[model samples]
Target chain A: MEKKRLYWRICCVAAIILSIITFTPLVIPQGVSKPELGGVPYSLWTSFVITVLLVILTYIGTRVHPGMQNEEEDL
Target chain B: MIFWVWVFGLIYAGLLVFASLRSYKKNRSSEEFMMAGSNIGLTLGVLTFAAALFSTFTFLGMPDFFRINGVAAWIFLAVSDGAMVFLLLWFGYHIRMKVKGMEFRGVAGLISRCYENRLAGYVFFLSSFLFLIPYVGIQIQGIAIFMDAAFPGSFPAWGWSAGIVLIMLIYSEIGGLKAIIFSDAIQGLLLLGVIWIIGWACLSHFGGIGPMFDKIGTVQEDLLSSPGPQGLLTPQFLFASLIAILMIPVTQPQFTTRIVVMKSMKTMQLMAVSLGAFAILVILPTIFIGMYGADLYSEYGRDEFFANAFLYDQPDAVAALAIIGLIAAGLSTTNAQIFALGSELRGLLRGNENSIMTKTKIGIFVFSVIAFFFSIIVIDQLVLLARVSFAGTGIMGPMIILGILSNRKVSPAIIYLSLTGLIIFLLSLGGWIPDMYFDIRLDLILFITLGIAAVISHLTGTKRQLIRPKTKE
Candidate 1:
């Protein structure tokens, strides 16, 4: 359970980091649309990648979240 | 088109009737009536949450947004939604545990219990009513506007709005929250189907994704990048929107109730993940539709763009399906908000179950009537009004999160602070005060201030002592 908590914490941190990264110029470079992948613009493609990653992180968070056992018992 | 409308409309109405009848039960317990027996499974859960979250706002508002504001609109809603589901997984656990083994009242009721204060509940209810009513109103207006375009000179927009409200009241009053959930599921699927059909049609116009952007780049290169033409969708605006949307599950009673009513915590968590994927699926197609609009109808007004793209441009069957699908989308969301208000009111009322149910139903009726009136008068861009609604209710987020997650007996100062924040937000929205100071948005500043105060309140709070329920005062 403790190890699960640690993994959940890591997942949370990674999610938060990804969210913060999205606002940076590296992702949403103002007035810049080059470095496009297959015709999608820069910000659009990068943010799209980040959005999917966050969902994947959420799926992993569900797997390792520490409170699931207690909650299941309550149910 | 009208022939197809009748065909699809009758089919949709039949499904709605079946769903409500399936949910109705005689002599049902108040718990069963108001809370759906606290047993919603994965499929229904995901669909209801999606339907409620992405309404006419997504259906009509998003394409218009992307058309005008450009690609950053994706970051505005889609990215924010992505992060919101992550927060949902974390917040969901804490809130579910907090309400475990207790009667799951609405968030206003549960937060009041967590804080041991009635005013906290009142404040929460007040913010929800203030914001949600107008949002619901505008959604009704959206449908009314579209209907008027579909059948010009048949009836006034207000007539359509009234009819929509009447149908919502009948089914919801008969079947309660369960009925609302079932309809939401139907609407979710319909919305997904109708949007993709229209989107695919639009994409076919462009030939492919590569040609689509290449074409848009020539028409307007700014549409291909951030802060497009009008210079909105800045980093600051998108980040602020992210916080507001993140607070949605925390502060919105409808969503909070859905979280608690899931069959188990596992389903709720999985629902969160699935909802993220669903958000992506739903919002992606809007980009194609938006790019299509930007390419074809760049100079058209909002109404013209909607009519041509969603109606006149499609085949008779597809256009008719758009009409029914739109009604389903707007109906599902408006009813969810109105029903949630009724639930919030039920939480604040003190009385016998039967009387409370009667009053709750009355309250829902009253709210629908008010929203009907609002639909006639409210006018703005659907997406912008929605953002205001979100940022408005979101002022209560810190208070709610602190109330639920803090095990300590925190002071009631946060409640008053939240009330102050709510007033400040309203004042700014009304333009009685500046929305930005020192180049920072007022809403963002308020979110930060209230969040910090909640942290301090928790730190200074006394540790709680549990007393068995049977021995409680």
Candidate 2:
């Protein structure tokens, strides 16, 4: 239970951090030459990567629950 | 070309009807019909959730958004969707626990019960209805606009709107939520496949991704960076938008009901992650398709650009398939929201269960009509209009969280604050009031104020009521 709460807080903080960096002028400034990564802007790539990264972390957090781990029946 | 398009449409419609009939046979009771017997598996849940969440907006509106706003459009949607998935993890767990302990039928009922007042439910329902009717209409309207352009004077846009709404009502009434989920899974797959196929075609037209973006840089350099040419994806706009979209699972009855009915918490959690991944897969292609538009059709009007890119640019076969896919996209999303309103009405109606079912069915038809009429009047710019709907409904998020997550009977002040916040935000949106308070977006300010009010109300009213998580017996 404590571990779940810890993960929950981490997820929330991660969300805020994501919003802060991507939506604000903290890292990627507005109306400038954005670096390209794989044919897309580096800023956009970072946002997508951060999103996937955090989701994986949250998925790992769900493994703390016994029912989640054992209930593997495919729909 | 038209013959093939009609054939695909008819086949898709036939399959949907067959799936609905299968579900109808199993849904012998009202509860089963409305709630899918409350144990939907992970696959159907994820597909339905994703199909409902991304629709014509992803297909048509998003490409247009990128054509205009540039690459920041990616961050605006993808990052917000990620936050929404994370929220589904956090909010879904607590709300499911809340549902297990209560005899509530919808978020409306649960929230009302938490506040111990019927008005809270009504307020919640009214907020959704006010925003969602237009949102649903935009889905239909988007396709109607395209239909008008594709067939040009064959049927009026309003006729197209009415026709689609009738189709949606027939299937939803036939099998209810289960049927909708079944069809949603089908639509989900078609939408993903068709978009990728078209996206690849568009990318191939420009040689490749790097060359395509390089071409865009030469044509319009501003589009390659932030604030685009239109300056629409501003920092404040994106930040407040993240808040609005993140609240969707909490505030939108369609998604809320979906989370509650999943076979288990594990299913809902997995569905959340899948939805995030699905969002990335689905939205990424729109960027390519939009870049194609920016290169060739930048000066064309919205309707012309959509028709040329979506239809004229493709081979007849793929374009025909895309027509069916667009119909599937628009109808899947429209059905979910309109039917959710029915489910919400069922939750709030005061009557015997049988009579409530009758009334709710009637209510769904009425709402569909309202949506059809709303569709005729809505202008183009599908994604932005849809975002307005998200923002409008999202103002109720704090009140809902307070209701679902608090152990003590929450103070009535929270409800009032939410209502006040919703009204101000709406007025601000309408230009009857200013949009910013102290240079902050009114919606953002409202969220903050509502959060503070909830805290103050909770602190003043309850000294020691612990919000203990409900353990299963």
The regions of model 1 sitting more than 4 angstroms off are A73-75, B467-473
Candidate 2's error at B212, in angstroms? 1.4
lDDT tens digits, residue span B336-413, model 1: 999999999999999798899899989999999999999999999999999999999999999999998888999999
RMSD per prediction, one decimal?
Answer: 1.8, 2.4
Residue-level lDDT tens digits of model 1 in A1-75: 999999999999999999998889989899999899998999999999999999999999999998886653323
Judged by DockQ cut-offs, is candidate 2 incorrect, acceptable, medium or high? medium
lDDT of 1: 0.93
Over the stretch B197-314, how does candidate 2's per-residue lDDT look in tens digits?
9999999988998898889989998888778899888888888888889899999999999999998788888898888889889998999999999999999888898899999989
DockQ of each: 0.64, 0.50
Candidate 1 structure, TM-score to reference: 0.98
Give per-residue lDDT, candidate 2, residue A68: 46
Model 2 residue runs over 4 Å out of place are A1-8, A65-75, B463-473
